[model samples]
Each structure stands twice: as C-alpha cells, then as structure tokens.
Target chain A: MLDAFLGWTGVVFVFIGVFFLFLGALGILRLPDLLNRLQAGTKSTTLGVVATSIGVGLIVRGWILFAAALAVFLLMTNPISSHAIARASYRAGVKLYPGTHPDKCEERKWKLPEDGEEK
Target chain B: MRNDTPILVKKITALSLITILMVGFFWAFTEMPKGSSVNVNNRVSRLYILKNVKAATKSLNSGNFFAKGMKPLRSDVPYSPITFGKSANLEDGAANVVTSIVVDYRGFDTLGEVTVLFLAATGVAMLFFGKRKKNIIKAQASLIMSVGTRIAYAVILLFGIYIFVHGHLTPGGGFPGGAVIASGVLGLFLGNDHYESNHLGLKLFESLSGMAFVIIGLTGLFSVNSFLANFLPTGVIGDLYSAGFIALIYIAIGMKVGAELSAVVDSMIVDTEEEWS
Candidate 1:
C-alpha cells in the first residue's frame, strides 16, 4: 500500500513537471515583450525543474534526495539570472509595448514629493 | 535586402545546427553514467560520531556522569581543538559552519570573496551610471498596492534584521540576510521613481567593515601563528558569548555584506535613472 501511494505521488509530481515545462515553452513563444517572456520562461521552467527533481527524489531515496535539493536551490537562483538578463536587454535599447506610460527612469529627474509638494 | 535575407537565413540555420550539435553531445555524454563505488569512509565516521554523540547526550540527560565525560575525538587534519567538557559548537556563532570556517579561520578566502563582490558592484555601477535613455514602461500601482507594499516592506526589513541577528543560530547568515535587505531596497525602487540610497553611508560602512576584518586578521598574525586565530578568550562553550573570534568575524561579515549589497542594488537602480536622463 505504501509503495502504491509513493508511486501515485511520483506520477502526480511528474505530471505537474511536464505541465510546467509545456507552459514555459508556450510562454516563451507567446509573451509579447522580452522582459515578460523572460519572466514566464524562468518561473515556469524553475517550477518544472523542481517538480521533476521531487519526483526523481521520491523514486530514488537517500543520496539522490540531496541532488534533488540542490536542483531546487538552483531553480530558485534562475529567476535572479533571468531578471539580470532582461534588465541588460532593456538597457541595450530593447523596445516594449506602445501604450506604456510615464517611464520611471525618465521621471527620476523631475520626480515630485509623495505629498504632491515640491521638495 | 534580398542578399541580407539570405545571409540571415544562413546564420539562423548555422546557429540552429550548432545548438542541436551541442545538445546532442551533452545528451550523449550524460547518458553514460560511470557509477563509482560509494566511499563509505566519511559516512561511516559520521554515523559513528552521531551514534556516540546521541548516546552521550542521552546519558548526560539521564544523569550518567561517566558517559557525560566522554569526549569525541576531533578531526586532526582540520586542527580543531579538543577541549574536554566544552561542547565547542563552531556553527553556533554562525548558522553556516562552512561559511564561518571560510570567513573566520580562513579570512584570506573571505578577502577574495569581498573583493569579488566589490568588483561586481563597481562594474555594474560603471556600466549603468550616468547614461540617459528613454524607458517607455510606467509603473501604475494603485493606492492600496502602494500602501500595502510599504507595510510589507517594513515587515520584510524587520525580518531581514532578524535573519542577520540570529544568523548564528539559524539556517540563514550574513550573505542571505544581506541579500534580503538589498531586496527590501528593491521594493523601494519598484514603488518610487527617485529613490537614491545614501552612497556616503554605504561607502563608509563598506570601507570600515573591510578595514576591521583586515585588522582582526592582523591581530591574529601578531598573537598567533595562524591568520584569523581565536585570539580572545574562548568563553563558556555553547553560550552566545562563546567562540572568541567567530562572533567578531560574523559581525564584520554581516556589516560588510549588508553595505556592499545595498550599494550594488543602489547603483543598479541609479544607473537606470542616468540612462533615462
């Protein structure tokens, strides 16, 4: 009974992993801007990796579990790297949607105080 | 235009071919898992230590005086002191023993790590500082979002402090806590447009903490044979006041990392502003 339960949990984890992997690929293809695409790709892929690692960990216990934990830790770091890349792309003159307004970077010079009063 | 189209097509094809080749090579190499025999030496030693430690601890709790006096043999290569009746919990001064070891006993490695951090900060600052370009996207946060975010920011700031303070007793230490503190500043960056960090204070903290670390190392040079030796009295073991040089090193690391990371984040955010102007 315990073995069956473990097998079912493993299958569920694998399914979730596959779902996240598909979602990440779809997001990469579908997202409009570079930043949005990067976010989608990193987040979904990280989740996918974590789920897959957990499934693998459950199937092969002991030392393999350490590998799974390491994978999850690596997954957590993926977003930070992706964010850096997206920021770099933005700084390198990548364009975004036409409707976006009042760029924070542009308004830094003429920024008004929080209370709508001049500093 | 026609020539350019063909060139682009050829480039794309070549890129894809290379990518496929690389992927195939990696896959093929990964498939051959040359399994090595498990070296049970460390595991066996660890198990033996754990068993004995557990029994000793149990006996101590149960008022068995003989078992309580038994001391575990310290590893000789590492040269950890074998002080009897003192549970020299090296990791108690910092959550990560490895980090404590690297930064405290091996202060030289920490010097390199800090230097790398400093270089990374300077590099990012130089790259982004004082450049002006247009950013089209605008942050349109609602009033509720703005207020709630500020509250959350305060909570996270406090949490970061907690992590830094109890770093000796917890899973988190200076680096992680410092990063968390940096993220809190990021929250400000997200919420406000013209949020500039106090550059002078950050620089002062960075320089001072770094100097203190060096001074501590030099003290060890004068007092002991090894660099970053525990020159101070090793107080009552297992107490917070214990671990002579360990606590001092942790404090120095905490200050340095916190300041450095804050400066880095500040620079990254400020550089974006310069690009816009």
Candidate 2:
C-alpha cells in the first residue's frame, strides 16, 4: 500500500511538472512585453523545474533525492538572479510595448519640495 | 536607394533560405530517436552514494549522537552542498547554517556571480545615470504614486535586510537580498531624481569588495590544497563554529554584493544629472 502510494505521488508530481512546463510555454507565447514575458517565463519555469525535481526525488529515493532537492533550490535561486537581469535590462532603457499604459518609471521625476510653496 | 533595395531583398531571401534549411536539419535529427530506446546500465557502482543515503538517514534519525557524527558529509566533493554547509558553519557564525554554505563554501562561484552583477550595474548606470548632454526634463508623478512609493521604500528596505540576515534559514541569500536592497534604492531613483548617490564612496566600496574577493580566493590557494578550499578548522559539526572557512566567505560575499549593488544605484542616479559646464 505504501509503495503504491509513493508511486502515485510521484506520478502526480510528474504531471504537475509537465503542467508547469506547458504553462511556461504558453506564458512566453502570450505575454505582451519583455518584462511581462520574463515574469511568466521565470515563475512558471522555476515551478516546473522544482516539480520535476521533486518527482525525480520520489522516483529515485536516495542520495539522488538530496541532489534533486538541491536542484530545486538552485531553480528557485536562478529566477531571482534572472529577475535582476531583467530589471537591469529595463533600467538600461529597453522599450516597453508601444500600446501599453505609460510606466510609473517613465513619467515619474524625483524632486525635493521647496519651502512649503506650491510651484 | 533603388540599387540598395535589391541587395537588401537578396540578403533577406538568403537568410530565410538558410534558416529553413537549419530548421529542416533540426527536425530530421529530433525524429531519429523517436522509436529507439538507448539501453542504460542499471548496475550500481560500489561508490554510488545513493546506497549509503538510506544508512545516513537512519543514522540521523537514530538517537546515537556519536554515530551520527561519524557519518560522512551528505554531499561529496565536486558536489557543492557539503562544502557550502561545512564552510558556512565555520566562517559566518550564522546559526541557521545553509546561508554560510552558499555564500562562503562556494565563494569563487559567488564572486563570478557578483561580477556579473557589477557588470549589470555598470550597464544600467551607463544607460540611466549618465550626465545628460541635453536636459531631458521629466515630469512629476501623481501624489498617490509618490506617497505610495515613499511608504513602500521603508517596507522594502526592511524586507531586504530581513532577507539578507535570515538567508541561511530561508531561501534568500546575499544575491537576492542585495538585489532587494538595490530595488529599495531604485524606488528612490524613480521617485526623486535630485537624490543622487555619492560617486566617490560607491567607487571605493566597489573596488574594495572586488579586491577582497580576489584576496580570499588567493588565500585558499596558498593555505589549502586548491583554490577556495577550507583553510580554517571544521570545528564541531552542527554548531555555529563548525564550518570555519565557510562563514567568513559568506560574510565577505554578502558585504561585497550589498555594497556593489548600492554603487550601481549611485552610478545610475548620478548619470541623470545635466551637464553644468
């Protein structure tokens, strides 16, 4: 019963993993802009990889489990690092979608208030 | 213009033809493995750690404290987890443990990653922070945005510090934490252009942290077997003092990354200034 349960859990994880991959692909295809696409790509892919790693851990069931867990941890970290890359890209003046609403960043200017006077 | 049009058209046609040919080749290679299953050797090697993992887990669960101590590091050499875990305990004095491993034990890789960050900061600085030859004046934002962002600044800053300090216990570490902290500064950059970072201090921090990284790597070569080896005592396992070399490496990486990212923000902000002369 326990063995069957483990096997079923493993199958479920694998299914989830495949589902995440499909979501990531769809996100990449459907997202409108570079930043939006990046958001979709990284989050979905990270979740997909983690799910896949967990599934592998269940299937292999040993030191390979530790390795799989490490892979999942790495997957989590990789996206944050990639997000930094994407943010850096945006700061470096990559354009947004033309029809998209004006960005908070593009319209905003920082200024100090002058002595309680309205300009 | 007329002559150039044909040349452009010819180039486009040739590029498309080559792309199609490449795609055809890829499709053909992908299908060749469809029906064929490569036989994999299922025989376990004597040294396969998978066999021992069960024993290790059992030892961990068993109440025999001394026997558990005798178990080898969970991860082997070339597999970084053990090295990171061992080193982090030794160097950082961090209690949660894993934070030290990622930051200190595999610090050289962390250094390379930091350099990538530095490069990114440089790129962002160049694009957004450079002195404007022409005055490109920006408009002020809505009160709601300005006020909301201001409130967010404090929250984000706190969150960044929380992430950095609690990195060992949780998923975040220096890289993520540093970026979070940088994001806080980015809030300031977006909200107010006049608030610029001190360039001199930023430069000093960037250079010093960068140098410290190199020095740390070199120290490993001189004191240990190879580069980035644990030159310090392993201490008692599972204690804060355990991973001697690892702790120091993590601290250095965290500080270096934090400072370097701040510098990146500084550079980007400074570049926004209009040329006075």
Candidate 3:
C-alpha cells in the first residue's frame, strides 16, 4: 500500500515538473528582451529540473543519492552561469527594456558604452 | 557564359552513373550472407563477448577433428555467468564490457586516437606560439560569478578524477574525464581575466603521461610477448583495484588529455599578434 502511494506521488511530481518545463520553454519563446528571457528560462528550468530529478529519485529508490547530487550540482551552477551571461550582455551594450527604471548598474560605476563601441 | 554539354548528353551520363552505382550496390548486397543463414558464432566478437577466446581456440585446435562426428565450434563451449561483484580471475576482469574491449582487446586504436588529438593540439598551439595578448572581454565578471567559479572548479575536478579512476567499473572513462577537467579550466579562464594555466607545467605533464602510456605498452610487450597485454593480475570484477592495467592506462590517458586540452583552450582564448593583421 505504501509503495503504491509513493509511486503515484512520484508520477504526479513528474507530471508537475514536466508542466513547469513546458511553461519555461513557452516563456523563453514569448518573453521580450534578453534579460527577461534569461530570468524566465533559468528560474523555471532550474525548478523544473530539480522537481523532475526528485520525482525520478522517488520512483527509483536505489538511485536517490545520485539524483540528489545532480540536483545540488545544478542548483549551484545554474544561477552563476545565468549571472555570467547577463553581465557579459550588459557589458556588450545590450539595451535594457525601456520600461525598466532605477538603473542599478550605473550605481556600480559600470560605464555603458555606445552600442557598437564594445565590439 | 561558358558553353555547356547538351542536356541529352548530361542526362545520359547521369543515368549511366546511377546505373553503375545501383548495380555495384546490388552485387555487394547479394554476395553478403543475410539474416539467420549467417552463423555469428564464427565471428571473433563472439569470443570477446563470451570471454572465451582462449578456451574456444583450444577446443577448436585440439586435433580430434577426424574422430569426432562433428567439428567443435566456439558456440559449443560453456561460459559461466558474470556477476558484478563476485566474478574473479577472468581473462579481462573489467565489469564494464566496453572498457574491457577498448582497453584490453583494442588498446592500440585508443593510442592512435590519443595521438590524433595530440597532433591537433600541437598544430593549434604552434599557430598561436608567440607572445599572446589578452583577448578582450568588454566587462569584468561579477563577484558572484568569480567566487562561484572557484567553488565549482573544485567539485568538477573531483568528479573528473572519480570518473577516470573508476573507468573499469563504470560507464565513464578517460576521454570524458579529461574533457570535464578541461571545462573546469575553461571556467577559470572566464572567471578571472588574469588567470593563466602554467604553460611549462601543462606541457610537461602532457608529455610525461603520454610517455607513461607507451612505457606501459612496452612493459606488456617485454613481459607478456604482446603489445598492451594485460600483464598484471586482474582482481575481482567491480572492485576498485580490478581490471589490471586498464585503470593505469586510463589514468595516463586522462592526465594527458586534460593537460593537452587545457593547453589548447589557453591558446585559443588568448589572442596572438597575427590576429591583428
């Protein structure tokens, strides 16, 4: 009885993870501007993957440790990688969405070059 | 415009070429034995799979062919089941069949592959040999990016070492392990603008590891009468110390590949004066 309940729970988790992954993909496609897309893509996908791996681990009890390790690794790396990309693009003069206000990068003494100057 | 052959002539040539190719393909296909008619027991790969090469060869060449009703074949030999942790004293003791084949059965091919990679790295390095200027990155990496890279590099390095060390028992091996380490080096490059790998150290390490591979092969030749033979005792399958020289060869390959690839990345990322022209 316990095994069956756990199995069903795992299946539901898997479905939820897949749904989130689909939403992330949709956001990547539909979101305007690079920074917003990066935010949507990274956050949703990280959550999606962690959920999916946990679900898989619950289903295959023997591989729980490996799945957990993978999840931890992903969690540590994903945000840093996204940060790197965003910093690089900003330096290269990718324009912010005009609606964005209170530009914080300028406060950090980051000189924004003209669009083609960085190249 | 240049004058072209007539359309009819072109059509005739193309048709003839197609006909010739089709005929050749059909001829080869017909010559090959198809489906269940072919006996796979006759293939050398069957011996490798069954781990019965020595025994099968002996049974076939035992010199009792005329007296027997039928000739002894490789398929006639009985093979015991290979358990993950229990099987021992095997001809090749690696738990992973792919590892056994690549390192034991066909090690020379792997050597050739490593050599090819070495040559390619050498060519790339030579092209960018002179004093290198830092490649321009418009902005500095953020504090989080730099700090996170340092933490991640340690973990990545540990994982790479684990992969190569456990090559005989697991799915991963030297090439992948080395690539993983090189990627960590690449992350280092991204995180720090001034960070440079020790060039002399990398070159020395790569050369020494490559030499170690050759020396091991030579040891096999001297002691066992064949190149890259499994000269050391293969312990129990799935054990850390198992698979005889496979682990040693993998370590050598992993180190060599890691150093060579790191050097290649270094050369590619740093700009040379020639690029300015």
Top lDDT model: 3
Q: What is the lDDT of residue B249 in candidate 2?
A: 56
Worst 10 residues of 1 chain B by lDDT: B44-53
Q: Write the per-residue lDDT of candidate 2 for residues B1-277, one digit (tens) a residue.
A: 3556778788898899999999999999987755447321122221121223334445446643244343333322232333334433223343444455455544567778878877887786655644543323343333444454566667667767667555545567666776777777776666553555676676677677677767777887898757775577656445545545554554455566766787766665553554432
The DockQ leader among the candidates is 3
Task: Summing lDDT over every window of 10 consecutive residues in candidate 2 chain B, give the lowest-scoring window.
Answer: B40-49
Q: What is the per-residue lDDT of model 3 for residues B1-277, given as tens digits with 9 covering 90 to 100?
A: 1258788888888899999999999999999997768764445565676665677667658743223444234435554667878888889988887889998889999999999999999999988988766556555566797899999999999999999999998998999999999999999988875687898999999999999999999999999999999999998888999989999999999999999999999988877777434
Of the two candidates 1 and 3, the one with more favorable TM-score, higher being better, is 3
* Candidate 2 ranges beyond 4 A from true positions: A1-118, B1-105, B123-137, B141-151, B233-242, B263-277
TM-score of each: 0.48, 0.42, 0.80
Query: In the order shown, what is each candidate's alpha-carbon RMSD?
Result: 12.5, 13.6, 6.4
What's the interface RMS deviation of candidate 2? 11.0
Model 2 lDDT per residue over A65-91, tens place:
675756645564555455555755665
Sum up the clashes in candidate 3: 0
